[model samples]
Target chain A: MSDGRDVRACLGVCDDAADDPQHRCHPQHVGLRRVGARPGGDRTRGRAGRLLQASGRVVGGVSVSIDQRLVELGIELPTTPAPAGAYVPAVVSGNLVFTAGQLPFVGGVLPATGKVGEGDGLVDPAEAKAFAATAALNALAAIEAELGSLDRVTRVVKVNGFVASDPSFVGQPGVINGASEFLHDVFGEIGVHARAAVGVAVLPLDSPVEVELVVEFE
Target chain B: MSDGRDVRACLGVCDDAADDPQHRCHPQHVGLRRVGARPGGDRTRGRAGRLLQASGRVVGGVSVSIDQRLVELGIELPTTPAPAGAYVPAVVSGNLVFTAGQLPFVGGVLPATGKVGEGDGLVDPAEAKAFAATAALNALAAIEAELGSLDRVTRVVKVNGFVASDPSFVGQPGVINGASEFLHDVFGEIGVHARAAVGVAVLPLDSPVEVELVVEFE
Candidate 1:
C-alpha cells in the first residue's frame, strides 16, 4: 500500500540506512537548557522537547541507525513505557548495551503509583520493592524479546534506580535494593555491577520507582 | 627495590586478592579522590561527590574487585588522557564499543592544553580541528591498545565532543567538526555517526577538547 516516496522518506529516518554526512555529524543538542525550569514546571513538556530535539538531530552510521535495521527486519520499537518514576530510558557505549527505562506495568499498563518508605497508603516499601523487582523482570523480558537470548550478556555493568520519593523517604536505596538482589539471583556474579540510586519528584504516571540495566555481551 | 611491606600492600589491592569491600568502596575516605573541587563551587563539589560515591559503591557482581582480564594477560591500561574541559569519561551499551574519554597524550603525558576555538591563540580552525582529530585518533589508539582490533568494530554510533571554550567561541561545532570529518575520512561511512557538541568551563590539563566514541563491532 506504500509508495516509493514513503519508502525513501522512511529510509531517510531509518537507523540502518546510510545517513547523509551532514545529518550524521549532529545527532543531538543536549545541554543544560533542556533540563528546564526546576520543580513542577511541566516535566513532560521539557522531556518531550528534549526527546524531539534528540530524535530530530540525525546521526548516520550502520549501527547509529540500529532501530531502522530492526524495522528492516520487520521489528517495531516498543512504546516508551511509563518509567516507574526516577530513571533514564537508555545509556550507550561502543559494542555494549543501553537499557530502556523500566516501569511496573500491570497488564501492559501502569497500575501502581506511590512513594516508597513514605506514608503512601497505596504501596508499602516491601510491596514497592516487589513492584520494582517486577519492573526489572519486565525490563529483562523486553531485552530478551529484542536480543533473542540472555546468553549474550557478559556483564550487567550499571543500574540506575529512580524512586518516586516523598522527600522524607530516605530509604530509596533500600527500595531499589530489591532490583540489585534480584539481578544477582538471576545472573550470579555477572549481575553484580555498578549502580546509581536517584530520587525523583515523580515518575511517569507517578509510579513508585523505575530501574534500568546496562547489559554487556560477548 | 621496594620493601616487603609495600609489596604486600600492593598485592593486597590487586583483584581477586584480599580486599576489604568497605575500604575500597570509600576511595575519597582514603584520600584517593582524583577529580575534585574545581572553581565552580557547590555544584561541582556535589557532582564530584556523587561521582565518587557511586564509583566506589559496588552493588553486586562478586565485587568490583575483578580487574580487567587483560591485566592477567600482562597488558596494561594506558594512562587515559583527561578531557580538556567539562565532559564525561565514557558511555556504555551492550555487545559493541563504548569509549572512555580520550585526550591527546604524547608519551603518556599532556603536552597541550587550552580551548579549541579561542583564548589559547590557535590560528586556523583547521589546525584546531586537526588537533581534535589527533585526539580522536589517540582515542582509537587507546581502544586498539586495549581491545586489539579495529576490525571488530561493527559501527561507530556516537561521538561526544567536549570543547574548552572562549566566550567568543561560536565555532564550537566547527572545531569538533574536525573530529567527525576525520573519523569518516578514516573509517568511511562506518566511522561517520551521531554526535553531541558540548561546551564546558575547563577540561583536565586544559587540552583544547576531548573526544569519545561509541563503536559497534562483531
Candidate 2:
C-alpha cells in the first residue's frame, strides 16, 4: 500500500481534497502515507518488516533519556529537537510528554519559510508540509527517547500549530493540514487527534511554521 | 516585606526588568498586585476583598467555565483568552489545562501590537514585561476554568511564548521575563516555572505576542 509513487500521488490528491472542507480522506489512508505504519500492525513479535513498510526510516540522531522498560519493547528513539530560542526543549510530568515548539529544520537551515497561500518565504507549503511532518517525526523521536518506543504512545492527543503567514492569508488550516494528515498517517487510529490551526503574524526563525505535540503513554 | 510603596517600587523595577535578562514578575505577582498582597506582610484573605480583586468586572469579553472544585477551594477564574485565529479557545484533559495562545487583548481591541526590540513595539522593557504579565493573568483564567481554583494548580509547570518581532530583533528572554516573574509573584514558589521564548516573524492579528501555559492540576 506504500509504494513511493503511490504515496506521492496520494499526497497530491490529499492536497486537492484539503482545499475542499467537504472532502475528508479516511484516517487509514493518511496513516499509510505519513508514518508508514498500518493500523493494528504489530512488531517485536518478529513482524518488524511489516511495521517498517508502514513508516519512514527512524534510524538515528536521537539522544535523550527514556524509560528502561520502554527500550525493551523495541522502540527506536529519533533525534531530539533542537531549541530555537531561549526556552528549553521539552518538559515531562508523570506519564505525559509536553514538547516545546518544533520547526522543520534540515541541517539547521529552514529550507522553506513563508505563508502557505503567499508562497514559501523561508520555506514553501509542500516543503513546509514536509517540514511540519518532519517536525512531527522529530517529536516522535523525542517521545521515543523519553518513553523508549513509539509503542508506549497511547495516542497523539493534541497538536498545536503556529504558521507564519501573510496578513491576508486564510489557508492556515490547509498549511497545517500537511502535518495533521501526516500524524494520522503515522499513528493510524492512534494518530488521529484533536488540533488547532493558527495563522500567526510570524514564527521563530521566520520559518513557515512551528509545531508542538502532546502524547499519552500506555 | 509588603510595604505598599516598597512593593510598588519592586514591581516597577521588575516591570522595567523585561529587557534586563534578570528578574521579571509573573502571574502570582499579578494576582498579588491586583489585591495589594505581598510576601511577609499583609495576609489579606477576606472573602469580599478576594472576589473584588480576582474577578473584577469582566475581561476579554469572554466568560470561562471555572471548575467547581476550584470554586470550593476559593479560587477565582479569570476571563477566557480571546482566540488569535480560527481556533477553539482552549482544551482540558484530566488534571491538566492547555490554553491557546493568549494575546494582550484587554477590552476587545489589542492595546498594543508590533515587533519588540524595535522602537518599543509594545513597551520597551517595562510595558512589554507588563504585557507578558497580563497575558499570564489570562492564562490563569483558563487554568481556573479547568481546575476550579488556582489552589488546584500543583505547579505552574511550563510556558511557551511567541513574540512578533522585527527582523533585526533579539530580545526574547527579556520579553518572557515579564510572565515568569509575574507567575512567581502570584503563586509564590509554586509560580516559579520553566519557560521558552522565541522570536517569531509574526503572530495572528499582528498581535505583538502569543502565550500558552501548561499547568498541573491538584
Candidate 3:
C-alpha cells in the first residue's frame, strides 16, 4: 500500500484537519507537513525532508502540550552549546533535526570525566547517567536553536548514547536511561524513541557520556 | 517558512507532479508519499514511515537507477542474517528503517574476530575494512527484507561504524571507509550520508567491525 500517491493523499487529509485542535493526523503526515513547510531553496531542505519523512508516524491520542509539560516539571532548556569540533550543533534535513553528539558539559566545561563503571578516579555509572541527562538537555537546546522552539517537535525519533566505559562495564543501557528518562519526563509519550546504547573505548574530550538525537518536528 | 500551510501546499504540488518521470518533489513530500502509500494498520507503518522519510532527499539530476548501479558493480545482495540478540534485524518507524548493528557474518558465522588495529592473531585494519563492508551488506539485506526491494530506498541518511580497536589504533574513519565506499559504489550519490566512525572497546560476538544504518526509502 506504500506508494507515492497514497502518502500525498493522506497528507492532504491531514492538512484539511489542521484547524481542528483535536484532529490528529498520522505522524507521517505531520512529518510531511514539516518538510513541505520549509523554503525549498535552503541548502538544508533536502536533509530536513529526509529526516522528517522518516519520522512521519505519530502516536495517536496524545493531547498534552509539550511546553506545558516542561513547565509542570520545572524544566528550562539551556542555551545552545558551542560545538566542540568543526561540525554544526545540529542540522535540519526534511522534517527531522539531527544533533551532533553532545558532551556532558555544564557551562562550557565537562562536569566530570573518565570512563563509566570504572573504580575510583573515574566516573561512576550513576554520575554518568546524570551526565547523560545533561548531554540530552544540550541536544534539546541545539534543537530549540534550530527550530526556534521545542514545541515544534513532534516526536523524539532516535537516541544514540555513547558511553566511555571501563573494560568490564556492561550497563551501557542503564547509563543512557538518564537521558531517556529525562526526555520521557519532558515530552511524555512523544518523547519515547528507539535508542542504541553503546560502550566505547573513549569519547571526545574524555567525557563519560555523549548523547545525540534524531527529532521529528511539526 | 516551515509552517503547516506551506508544507501542505508544497506536498500538493508534489502530488500533482508525481506522474512525470522527471518530476522531483521536495524530499519531505516524497517521504510522505512513501509513508502514505503503505497499507494503513500495518504494524510496520510507523517504522516504514520513519525510514522512508529520511531517504526522500534523492540526489537530484542523477538519472542512474540504484538497480543499474548494483548490476554495473556486479553486486548481489546476500541473504538476510538473523539477529544475534533479542532485537529484530531492522525496524521501520515512520519513513525510516533502522538496522541493528550488523556483524560480518557469512552463513551465520563471523569471518574474522578480534580488535581492528591489534597485531597478528587479531583482524587487521585492512581486513576489518572489508568486514565493515560485509557488515554493511548485511544491513542492506535486512533493509531489503523489510522493504521488499532496495529500489524503494531514496537515501542513506546516516551510518554508524563501530570498530573494535586496539588501544593504540586511531584509524577508525579509514576502516569505516570500507563500508562507505561500498555503499557509494552501489547507491552512488544517494548513498552519500552523514557518518560516525567510532572506536569501541569490544563488540557483540567479538567481531572486528559492526555497522548499522539509518536508511530512508519510499
Candidate 4:
C-alpha cells in the first residue's frame, strides 16, 4: 500500500509499519484512506493544513506533515507545564483556544530570570528570545492539553509578547521574534500572525519574557 | 413572544420590534430563539455569561438587557479608531473575532500619556484605569466594524490588558479593572472573560494602557 507508506511518512510514525501489524492499520491510517479516497480531497488544503504544507516538505504530491517536520527538525513538544497560580492554563470557547500568559519554565523551574536588555547584570536579549520560545512552547502545550491535538488548530491568530526591559532598551520585537520564528518554523505561512511586542516593567515570577496566544481551531 | 423578549433581553437589544421594523428580526435573534427553545437553554449561562448576569438586572426571570443597561449607565460606544500602523483593527476567522491592540484614543487623540503609577507628576492610576476603559471601548468599536452589530458576540473569551507601569507599581490587576468593569457594564455576564493584566515598560504612542480582545460570535 503506497498510500499507507505516504500516511506513515507524513505523520513521521514508523517506516516499518508494513512489517509491523500494529502500525499497518492504525486508526489514523484508516482515516487517511477515507480522506484520500474522495475526489479533489487534499487534506492539507485548509488553513491549518496550508500552514503545514508551507514547510515545502511534500512527498508523493502530498503536503508536508507537522509531525514529520517536527521529527526532521529534531524538535519534541515538551510536557504541559503546571500553572504557577490559581488560574487554569488555557480556556476554549467556541472554536478558539486562549492560552494564559506563559513563562519559560522547564521541568517546573525557570531556566533564566531578570529583565531583558538590562545589559551588564541581567538577562541578555538573545537569551530572552530563547525564553520567549520556551514560553510559547508552554502555550502550545496548554493548547494541546485543552484540544488533545495540535492538528485541530486552523490558524495562529495572534501572539502577544511582553518583555521586561530596561528603560533604554527598545529591542522588544527582536526578543519576541524567538517565539514568532519558532511558530513559523513549525506551522509555516499559517503560523504567520499579527503580533504585539511591548517592553514591560516586570513579569510574573520576574521572568524576562512571557508569551500568550489566540488560536483558531476546527 | 416572551421567548423573543428573553433572547432580546439577554442580548441587550431593543424591545420595540414593531415600532422599528428593522429591529424586529435580526439573524442573531433567530439563532438565540433556537438556543433558547432548547431544554435548559440558558443563553448567558457559561463563564462569560455568568459574569454578565452578576449585574443582577433580571426582568421576568431573564437577564436584564445589555442595551437597556447601557442606557441606564449612560454609556455609548465610541467610533472605531483608525489603526496607528499597517494592521487592520480586527480579523474574523470562522466563529471567532480577534481585535488588534487598541489605545485609548477618544476623538482621535489620547486623553492622557505616560506610565501608570508614575504619579507624583505623571498620570494617576485612577485616570489610567479610565483610559483602559476607553481602550476597551475602542476594541469594541473594532468588533462592531467587523460584525455590524455588537449583539452578534456570544462571549468575550479573553481580554489582554497591558499597562505601561512605573517600576514601583504592582496594582496591574486593579488598573485593568477599568476595561473589565466597563465590559461587564455593557455586555453583562457575556462580557466576563479570562484576562491577563501585564505591566509593560512602554506602549505605542506612549499611551498609558492598551487593550485587545478575543470574542466568539454566532
Candidate 5:
C-alpha cells in the first residue's frame, strides 16, 4: 500500500512512518527548518552532493529552496500539462498565481476514471488519493511554467480538491488529504495551507479527481 | 423570469434589458465609471441618498465606491452563513482574503437540492445559475464580517465555482455566470476575475452550486 512517497513533513523524525500507512504528516514548522537538527540526516547516494550546494544550505531556520527540496525527495517534476480548452494552465496576478483545475495527467493521460467508491464500476479511495497527489504535482508544473521557476513561490496558499463520488461516499476530505499532505512534504512549514475539499457529480474528461491551486510567490 | 435582479453591470445603460430574456450582462466597464456616462444613472429610493455620502464619489475615473454601486443595484448583502464544519468562513493573508466554499443558503436553508441537469429529478441550469450568484454574495458577507467592510475590497481576484451535476450536464460555465455577473453588477471593473468552473457529482447539503472567492483589498 506504500506509494513510496516520502514523509519529510517532520524531516527525518518520522522516517519509520514514511512507508507505514497509519501515520500522516501535519507539520507545525511554519516554513522554518527543524531547529533541532538530527545531525545525520538521510543522504542521497547520487544527488551529486547537493546537500552542501549553495542553494540548499540551512540558514536562520528558513526552509530549504523548493528546487533543492525536490532533489532531496528523489522526485523529478514532470512536464507542464497543456490547457485543454480556452483557458491557459495558470495565470499570475500580483504575487499569486491561480491555476486552472488540473486532472491527474501522467504523461498526457488520466490514469483512471469513474466515481470514487467501493464496489463495482467505482475507483478505490486509496487510488483516488494517489491521483490527488499527482494532480497537485501537475499544478506545480503549471505554476513553474507561468513564473519561469518554482523557486519564486513563497507559500502554498490554498488547494481546492474535487472528488467524483458515488453520492453515498463521504470520504472527500480523506481523498483531498493526499494533496494537502504532499504539499507539506515538499514545502515543509510553508506548505501548510488552508483547503476546501468537496464531492462533485462528475468532472471534465471523466477523471476521478480535479485539483486547483492558489500559490503565493515573491 | 426577471427574478427582480437588476442589470447594473452596464451601470443602468441596459435598464430595459434588465427584464428582457434575450440580454445577459457582459460588462466591460473594468470597475471604471462609464466615461461616456449615460446622462442620468438610476437613483435609489431609500439609500438615504448614499450616492453623495462622504465615502461615495467619482475619483480620477477609477469607479464609484462598491457601496454606492450596491445601492444602485438594489442588493443587500445577506448575513454571512455559518461554516458547516470546523473551518472559518474566510481567512486573510497580506492584501488578499480567501473565502471558504459557500453554498447558496437563503435564510439558513437550501432553496433546492438535486444535481443540476435537465429532465426529471434534476436542478435546472437557470435556477442553478441564480444559486451560484447567491453563493458568491454569501462569500462577500464572510469577507465583510472578517474585514468589517466590503469597501476595503479593491479587486475580485479569482472565483472557483463548483456546480453539482447529473454527470451529463455541461453548463457549468453558464451556471457560474450567475455569480460572475452579480459581482460585476456590484463592483464594476474590479469585479472581473480569473475563474474556473467545473461540474461535480454533488455538493454538501445537496446544494446545486458552491462558490468560493479570492479577493484583493487595499
Candidate 6:
C-alpha cells in the first residue's frame, strides 16, 4: 500500500480523470475505476479485496477518486466555513497548505458547546468526536476552496486537534481520532497522517473542538 | 531586507560561520559579520545604518546572526524541553520542520500556572506574555535540536499559539505576540510569519501558553 510507484500511477490516472470530462469517473459513479476493466485479482485481504473497484492501485483494488469516495461514504462537503477573524481559511506555502484552526460549524452554527467530559452539563466525548469529524470536514472544505479540488492533495501531513475538555478529562487522542479517521476514510491510504491532540481550556465561539491541517499537494 | 540575493548570501555566510568556528559568529562575537568588511553604505535608515556590521544584507545592516542576536538581546535559549508524550519534538518534511506544541518551561519548571485573565488567582497577562515567549524559545530549541543549527533556517513559516483562557480572556493575540516578537528578534525579517492565536479552555500541565512552529530550512 505504501509503494510509491503504485500510488503515483493511481494519482496520475485520477488526474487524467479530472482533466478529461468525457471520462466518467465522477462522484456517485461507483469506485474511482471500474474493477471489471482490468482486475489484478489480488487476494490479500480475503473476500474484501474482491470488492475493490477503485483506481490504479490494483493491490487493494479499492482506491476511488477522491470525489467519488466522498459520495460513496455518504459525506457531502458543506460550504467552506467563513473565517471568524482577520485571516484566510488556508494559506499555501511552497508545496504545503496549512489550514487555520477550524471549529465545528455546521450550517453556520455550532451543533453543541461546553467543555467535554463524562459529567452532567458537559458535552459528551461521543458528541465531541462527531464535532471533531465535522471540523475536519471544514478543514477539507477550506483546502478545496484554496486548491479548487481536494484531488491535488498528495499527502495529509499532520493534524493538530484541540478539544475543550473538563479538568477531569484526558481523552484528547480518542476525541481527535474522529478527524483522523474521517481523513483516512476520504483519502484512503494517503489520508493517514501524523497527528497531535491536546486538551485546551476553551476554543473560539465556545466550540468544543478545533482542528487544523498541514497537507502536501501537487 | 526582503531581497533574495542578500538573504541568500547572508544565510550562506552564516552557514560558513557555523562550518568554521574560527570565523566566529559565536554568541560572544559582536554582530554576525563586522559592518567594517564591505559596507554597501545604504542611506535608507540614515545613521542607524551606520551600525550595520552584520552579514551581507546591507539594506538595514541590523540583521544579526540568530545566535549573536539572542546574546545581544540578553536572551539565552534554555535546554530543549523534553516532550511529555509519545512523539518527537520536531519533524522535518521536505524543506519544512514542524515542531510539537511547546509550553513555557524554564529550567524544567513552569514559572506560573492557571488560566490567563484579569482576576485574582489567574495568570497575569504580562506574565502569560513572557510565558508565550518562553514557549517560543522552547520551540526554537526543539528546531535547533532537529536541524543541528538554527543557521540553516531560511524562513519562519507559521506559528500556532494556544493560551489557556479564563473564559473572559480575549487578549490571545497580545499574549501570543510575545512569541511572534521574540521570533522577529531572533530571526530578523525571516522570523515574521503568518500566525494563529486561540484561547483554549485549558492545556496539558495546566500551562498558560503553548506555541508550535513551522519553519523552512536550507
**DockQ of predicted candidate 2:** 0.12
Best by TM-score: 5
Candidate with more favorable, higher TM-score: 1 or 3: 3
Model 5: residues >4 Å from true position, as ranges? A1-62, A67-94, A97-101, A105-110, A141-151, A158-174, A192-206, B1-22, B25-100, B105-112, B117-134, B145-148, B157-160, B166-201
Q: Estimate, for each residue in B38-97, the C-alpha lDDT of model 4 and write its tens digit.
A: 123333444344334443356447765556655555556677899999999999998889
Interface Cα RMSD in Å, per prediction: 17.7, 9.2, 12.4, 15.1, 9.7, 14.6
Cα lDDT of model 3 by residue, A76-123, tens digit: 666778898899999999888999999977778898888887577768
Candidates 1 onward: DockQ, in order:
0.01, 0.12, 0.07, 0.12, 0.10, 0.09
lDDT of 3 at A214: 86
Local error of candidate 6 at residue B121 (angstroms) = 1.0
C-alpha RMSD for every candidate: 23.1, 11.7, 16.8, 14.9, 10.6, 13.9
**In candidate 6, which residue ranges exceed 4 Å CA deviation?**
A1-96, A106-109, A124-126, A145-148, A167-177, A194-199, B1-94, B97-112, B141-152, B158-174, B181-207
lDDT of 2 at B132: 72
Per-residue lDDT of candidate 2, residues A1-218 (tens digit): 22333443343334346534356685423323332122222333422432332232231333222333224323333456444322334445657677666766554556665555544344455555666766665667656655666666766788887776666666666666667766654554455567887766555445677778877776
Off by over 4 Å in 3: A1-62, A71-76, A79-94, A106-109, A167-174, A188-205, B1-113, B118-121, B124-130, B145-148, B155-160, B167-207, B214-216
Off by over 4 Å in 2: A1-32, A35-79, A85-87, A93-95, A107-122, A168-174, A181-186, B1-93, B97-117, B120-126, B141-152, B157-174, B181-212
DockQ pick, better of 1 and 6:
6
Arrange candidates by lDDT, highest first: which order? 6, 5, 4, 3, 2, 1
* Model 5 chain B: lowest-lDDT 10 consecutive positions: B30-39
Tens-place lDDT digits, model 5, residues A1-218? 11012222323443223222223233221111211011133433322232122123243467567777776655567787777789898999888899999998888988899898768999998788778878988898899888888888777777888888888665665676567656655665455455667897778889899989888888
> How much is B18 displaced in model 6, in angstroms?
37
Sorted into a CAPRI-style docking class, model 6 comes out as: incorrect
Candidate chain B TM-scores, in order: 0.55, 0.64, 0.70, 0.72, 0.74, 0.73
- Angstrom error of the Cα, residue A40, model 2: value is 26
